[model samples]
Structure formats: C-alpha cells, structure tokens
Target: MSKLKLDLIKNSISYFREAVAYAQRDELDETRWKFAIINVVQAMELAFKEKLRRIHPALIYSSVDERTDTVSLKKALNRLVDPGIGGLVIAEKDPRKIETAVKLRNELTHFECEHEHEHMEAKFADIFSFMIFFYREHLGLETEEFIDYDEHQRIIGLVKARAELRTRARSYIKAENFIDVWICPSCDESTFVAQNGECCFCHHKEAVIECASCGQETLESNVIDTSNYLDWDYDEGRMVLMEDYGMEMTACQGCIETFKSKVEDMRQAQYYEYMEREAMSYSR
Candidate 1:
C-alpha cells in the first residue's frame, strides 16, 4: 500500500477508537456525545476516501481532472455504490442511516442544535453498528483488531436497545392506524404520524395546521404566513389596506408560489390606482 493509503487507514482507525471511547463513557453527557459523533463521522469519511483511493487515487478527488480537493462523504458513498465505478454494495437502509449520522455530525460541528438524549444515543448506536460491519467486511479487519471484546458487547447492547425502541414504536403506530406516517425530524425514525403531528418514537410534537389558501393540512413550520409578506405601513405600525388578503391568510409549501403571485398582483393594482389619482390631481 502507498504511504498515503496507510496514513488514511491509520487515521480512520484512530478516530474510530476515539469515538468509541467517548460513546462508551459512563456519564455520556452532551459534550461526550457531540465528540463521539464528530469523531465517528470523520472515521467513516476517511475510510471512504481510503477505499476510493484503493480503487483509483483520482477517484478520491471531487473532480478527477482538477484533483484540487477530496470528495465529500456523500460523493464517496455515491461513487462506492455506483456499479460502473467502485462496485461496493451497501445495505439498503445503510445509506439513510449514514445520511442521518452525517447530518448530526454537521449540526454538532458547524451549528447549535438540541436533540433529546435517548434519540441521540439511538442515532449513535445505529451508526456504530453499521461502522463495525463496514470495518470488518469492507476494510478487511478482524473483530478483535478494532474493538475489544467487552466494549463490543456494550455496543451490541446499545444497538439492541435502539432496535427494541423502534419495534415498540412501530407496534403502537400500527395499532393506532395512522394514515400518514412520516420520518421523525427529531429522531430520524419512521414513526412520526402526520395526523397526530407527533413522533411515536421520540414523542416529539409539532403543530399541524390547515393551510388557509389551499385547505390542506401540513406542519405549521411548512406554512408561510401571508401576513408577513403583506406591505407594512411603518408610520401607522400596521399592514397596508388590501381588500381580500387578510392577516389570517397562510399558504403551505405547495401553494406558496400562487400566494406570492396574488400578493404581487394586489401590489401592482394599488400602484396603478395611486398613479391614476396623481394624474387626476395634476389635471385640476
């Protein structure tokens, strides 16, 4: 192996070890979880790049021709899964799990966001399980090489707990017979019921309201309040008068374009009326 490939593999294993240490801490506080996620994701990305480099060193770069920067985690995964390219076959659900892990890593690294402790733990557990398999099967490492026997058992416990939680949540959702099941934004679990506006897995709640314009139900966050788009009268500290568009008007994501068009047409009409009045005054 080239020195570069050796370095990549070494760094990837090192990061994975550090991540496991953080994840298996007794306290497992927010700071520990944050670092655990960051390290594990870094490990995954390096491993991906290393695999790509093995296939073709040029494939590691974002553009093979330019060779300026390395490929992103997403890009690396795409290349690995491409039959004509890397020819690595990943599990069906692994892509989504990796995507969730990447999102959490980015959120922890670049921004501030709060996640429930259990939900975070479940996410970490899911990624950890997948990474272990990747290291053994893809990276060609023995189980004893990367993870200690005791630590491996603990990690298995974590994965099992997450699986049990999902099973229970799914059973409840099935019993309730919710028509519109969605993935929970909070937990990244497929137990959020649109009708209830709550996640069965994480129990996270969001407001679901009917769109004023389209009369279709959607998450309140997905709806644009037309009142905010209306012309404001700063001097009077109120919205400028319009005949039909009221403060209560709202448009869901789908109807926002139509709503904007209507608002624009109304503004144009008001401008035309003002111009006509100015013309009449000048004639006098």
Candidate 2:
C-alpha cells in the first residue's frame, strides 16, 4: 500500500481506540474494559500496523452470525444507527459512497496481494470514501444541549474530504467475475482472465461473452476484462457467480482493453442502485 493509504487506516484505528476509551465507565471494573480493548486491538494489530482500510465492514468486524441476520454493508451500517443500538460504533454516509467504499476498501485491505492491487489502485483510490468511527456510547449529551455543531462540523468536514478523495481516485471496473482458470492452447499453462473465456497466451475459447469496450463478441473463461452480463447464482442463501462477462478464445491486448471498458459500465450501475436505496431511506 502507498504511504497515504496506510496513513488513513492507521489514523482511523487510532481514532477507534480513543473512542472506545472515551466511552469507558469509571464505576465499572477496569479489567473488563482493559481485556475488551486488548482482544479487539490484537485482532486489528496487523490491520493497524498495515493500516487496514477494508471495504467490507463485515470482514473487518468479523463478528459473524451463523443463524441470524446477514446483509450488505449499507444495510448493516443502517442497523447500527438504529436508536436502539446506541452503543455500536459505526459510520453513516451517503449509501452510494458506503457501498463503493466497501469494494474499494476490500481491494485495499484484503485483495492487495492477489487482485491486481498495484494495477487497479489508481482507480480504486478515487472510489475510496471515509468511514468515521462514531461511538454507540454518546458523550452523555442530550439532543438540544448535547450535540455540538462544532464537533459535528469537524467530523463532517473530515468525512467530506475523505469521500471526495475517494471519488476523485475511484475507477469503475467490474472484474469480480474475471477470476478463472483456463488452459492455454499454445503454452498449455493455466492462465486466468478477467472478462471472457479464453486462454492466457494463445487465447482459445472456453466460453463466449460480449466485449463492452468495442461492442465485439468473445469467449468466456479467458483472461479478458470484466465487462458484460454476469452469471449470478444463489448458494447457501447468497449470490455466487457461474460465469465471467468478458473473454475470448484468443488472448490479445485489444480483448483485455475491451474487458476493462465494460467494468466501468457495471460500476455505474452499482452506484445507481446504492443511491436508490439512500433515496428510499430519506423518504422513510
């Protein structure tokens, strides 16, 4: 990760720790608080030192439920903001940004080594948004007399700055389905493609898909771009993919460029969906 990206994660983690401490109870046994802090921090130590800025709040939180609720990051964050759950620390934001941040943060945090982190980073940076740490435990302030405009202004300013940075650096690419294995017809090596169904070197056809960039047709399961219709499946009550969108039997730079172009289109669709949800929230 770059120095700037790392700094953001570190700063957020530090703020998280301070918020927890600020909410500490003097009347209760300090041991409970101490252990709680240690346990959570230990899990996040690598995250802190490495400046873990993840798009998936669930992955970072990792407090899973085997038989209970499950949902998107936006939904989960909304749940945290319920008046009933005033004790959870969470970030509230424009639903679109939160959703975009989820993916970018995931790439920045978890997919760095494998998901073309270096190549895709320029675009990812623009999509990265700020998620402020708000404590569930309020500072003993009532609504009219408790909430201070100065504090709200400071936090909002920071959040806006972070979000703007993300927007500026973000790129739209739909490569989630690009991961696949295919045998090269020429080299006979197993190669992965992003968009279509083709071989890595000597592009050979496995499956065919549409090219988003140039409106060309191509193969599936090939080292291509992530642009086209995705095959989504339900597994264990979750959505999974059956096929990639772009790729062809023939491996070429032109094909790859085409795949990249399609990804941007898909990203726009994703943004729109997220914003729609936010609009609903306001109406409610």
Candidate 3:
C-alpha cells in the first residue's frame, strides 16, 4: 500500500511540475500534463490488478479497446471474482483527486489550455496517509487528537491541513465548528468535529449550534444550552461583542462551523506570491 501510494504521488508530482511550468508560461498544454497523469492512473489500475490477482487468479483482462479512452478502470477492478478485497479501491484514491487528474487529462486530450490554476489541487492535496493509516495503524492518533472520522476522511483532513499549513492552523481549523468538516472552502482548512449544532460562533441566527472553539470534544448527542452565549447576540445586524471572541472562536460546539477555506484569502494571495518567488528560485 505504501509503495503504491508513493508511486502514485511521485507520478502525480511529475505531472504537477509539468502543469505548473505551463502555467508559468501562461500556456497550458493539458495534453502534455494529462498524458503524464494518465500514466499514474494506469499505475493505479495496475496496482489494483496485481492486488486482485493475489486474492484470485480468475480475474482476466484484454488489451484496451481502440475506442475506449481507458479513463475508468472498472474492467480491471471487477476482474477479480472474490469479494474479499473490499469496496472499490478507486474510492480510496478519492474521486475528487481522480477528477483532478482526469480533468487535466481531458483538457490536454480535448481542449488546449483550460486549467484555471497554475497547478493541480490534488498535487498539493497532501500525502494524507499520515493522518489516515499511519496515525491510527502506526502512531494511534485516535479521537483523542481530534474528532471521529473514518481513517480515510481523517487522512483527507490532515493532508489538507498540512498542505495549506501557511494559511491554516490546526488551531484555526478547530476554530471552525462544523460537523464532520472533511473540507473547508473558505481558507482551505479542515477539521474533525465530534458534536454538531451551531457554528463556532453562536451568533448565527438561522442555525444555532454549540461547538467548542478549543479542544477536540463533541458528543454524538451532546446537548448545550443555547442561552449560554448572551454576550454575542446580534445587535440589529452587528455582532455585539462583550467578552473574549476567542472563546467563541475557540471552543465552538456548533454544527458545520468553519470560517475560512484552506487559507484565508489574503493569506492565500500571499502564498501565491511566495510560490511565485520560490518557482523563480527553482529556475535560478
């Protein structure tokens, strides 16, 4: 598993580099990068095929049909008759990530230049196996370290967090009081929420939930008093602040309480600037 992930990561990075170069020149060759990424996808399928053969040798495959683009690996994956392997391993790689690779592939395959960013999201998606398999299987970073999530989501969250480390802080992520925050679009931040109710800030009028802004603690059925936040009531339209907003930002027990995405907008702009500098440094 580790080796497969590493290979995919290395290949993904290769495509990412090619894509970024195109972006820097303001001339994206989707095909150039796309072809590079499909190699990774093919690698993924091959890994699956090898794994499937281990469980059952009955699985067989034919050369790719001349017409078929080979985007989906259903044929390779389904070849194994044994149900013991588990649900689609494709899901394990995240359709979102696959979509990224596919999108890059398609743009290059069909269009000429269409990638919005100078880079790929999945390329920087974070090698989340750390928070996924390693944390639990190896280091044992259970709910004690954060909220409850499948090892996959946990891995996803950690990968995102570290990838956007410049813009996000684990402390800030804990600040967003969302229920099961697998992803945050605002600052590109992510968190593991246990309890669900209001945003971290009880100021929300529509959804009143109680989420802690500090510490990782949320009960499946944890009940919090709504009237507790008397100080932060809305005064007309402005949020009336009487005490520490950090407290509200800290231990918010609300449901779906996220503030920013991976990184704050300003922070992200700065991040891009720095990246620009670094890219120049690489050439230097």
Candidate 4:
C-alpha cells in the first residue's frame, strides 16, 4: 500500500476511536452527536474501502476510471457483500443497518436536525456495536484497545438483551424452519438460518442454486439459468432434433459467460458456412 492509503487506514481507525468517545460522552450537544454518527459511518466506509484496496484496488471505485471524489459509501458497502456484483463477502452483516446510519448522516449533513438526545444516543450505541463487530471480525483489528471498557460491556449487555428477546419471540412462534441446522457458506459454521430473505448469522442471504454443468450447489446469485431450451443432436453428418429432450442447464456465471462465447463463435462459423453454400448455389 502507498503512504496515502496507509494514512487513510490509520485516519479511519482514529475516526472510529473518536466516535466511540463521542458515544461514551456523559452529555453531548446535538451538533457533536451528529458529528459522531457521521464519523462512525465514515469510519466504516473507509475501513471497508481499505479492505477492498488490499483485495483489489479497483474495488474501491465504482468504475475502472472512477475518481477519488466519486467513491461512494453505497458502492463501497456493495463491494464488501453484494455477491451478484462481485462482493468479497467480508463484513457479512445487516447492510440495511449501515445504510440507515448513512441515511442519518446524509440528513444531518443537509439539514439542521434536532431530535431527542436519547434516540440519538441509542442510535450511536447501535452503530458502536456494529463498528466493534466489523473491526474485530472483518478488519481483523483488535478492538480491546480501541473500545472503551465500560462502553464495551454496555454494548454487550444490549446485544444479550436483544438476543434474549428474540429467543423468547422464537419460542412463541414455534417455527422449526427458523432454526439453524446447516453450516453457513460465508462463516462456515452451524449458525446459518434464514427468515424471509436474510440470513440469521451473517445476514448474507439464502440463495441456493445447483449448477447443471458441474452439478455443484452454489449461491443463486452466482449462477445463471438460461430459459428452458432444446438441443439438437448430430447423427451421421445430419442435424436431428431430439423431441423428448427436456433438460435445462443452469451454469455458474463464469461458466455461462464462457458457454455463451463459445456459442457465439459456433454461430459465426455456421453463418459463414451458410454464406459459402449460398455462393456455390448462385454460381451453379
């Protein structure tokens, strides 16, 4: 990494520590509270982009020629988790929560907002929890030194409280399907379960697809299913249609792209052959 990139990573961590301080402040003015939220969002954005830079610098930009000013928080988050768009699957948590924080930052930046301090305080706490989790898990940062000891315990308490409430609700619902039995593809543990469209552990998603060519199960987001079609068979120098063939080939996105390229080449060759035959007929 260049010095500039290294500085950015350091600066982001510094901003996160500052945000933690703001969250832990006994009394905070509205202006300072808003800044704290902004810093937290910025920290996550920078942190994710830094990780992306390590994996592939092009990932930090929306396009190959994207400028520094155009690097967006939404794009950064997508690069980290959006599978269809080639995300790295790091920071596999509820993206909506981060989006909500970003939305709050936007509103604060554009308008002079005044809200209950308690509401803002709760939001900050939640962001703090998310930040700690991301830093420790995704960024591989040791959060013990960065997080305030007392605040860390408070955040842990809040998470535990929420988990207990969710457990009680699950018991009332008595839904067996909601229970996790399969190992998560992302986390590689037994903590994989989905409710609605979201995964319980990583919040990644439940997208199962079986590749027709490879016969391997993969995420639906990573595969392409061509509309059902029939294949003709070549028999003794003659093309014959198989009326009873009814197999749909679903391929991985990579395989699909390769297959399409080959199909196009074959089509071009056939077109030239037909043109040659037509020319011969015209001469005859």
The candidate maximizing lDDT is: 1
99-204 per-residue lDDT for model 1 (tens digits): 9889988988898888777767767887788788888888899988777899889878877877898999999988988888876766767888998889888788
On residues 165-278, what C-alpha lDDT tens digit does candidate 4 reach at each position?
446544543555554344444333344453333334334466665677566655666666654333467899986655312334567764766656555676677779999999
Candidate 2's displacement at residue 242, Å, is 20
Off by over 4 Å in 4: 66-70, 84-93, 148-151, 154-284
Q: What is the TM-score of each candidate against the true structure?
A: 0.72, 0.22, 0.32, 0.51
Model 3, stretches more than 4 Å misplaced? 1-36, 57-71, 74-96, 117-121, 124-284
- From the highest TM-score down, the ranking of the candidates is 1, 4, 3, 2
lDDT, candidate 3, 20-91, per-residue tens: 333223225444334434444444444444444344433423443443232145555454322554343334
lDDT of 2 by residue, 179-267 (tens): 44433332233442435554443343455555544455444433353423455688999877664445332333446654555555776
Find the candidate with the highest TM-score and give its number: 1
Better of 1 and 2 by TM-score: 1
Mark the 10 consecutive residues where model 3 has the least summed lDDT.
Answer: 198-207
User: Per-prediction count of colliding residue pairs?
Assistant: 0, 39, 38, 0
1 or 3: which has the higher lDDT? 1
Superposition TM-score, candidate 2 onto the true structure: 0.22
lDDT, ranked from best to worst = 1, 4, 3, 2
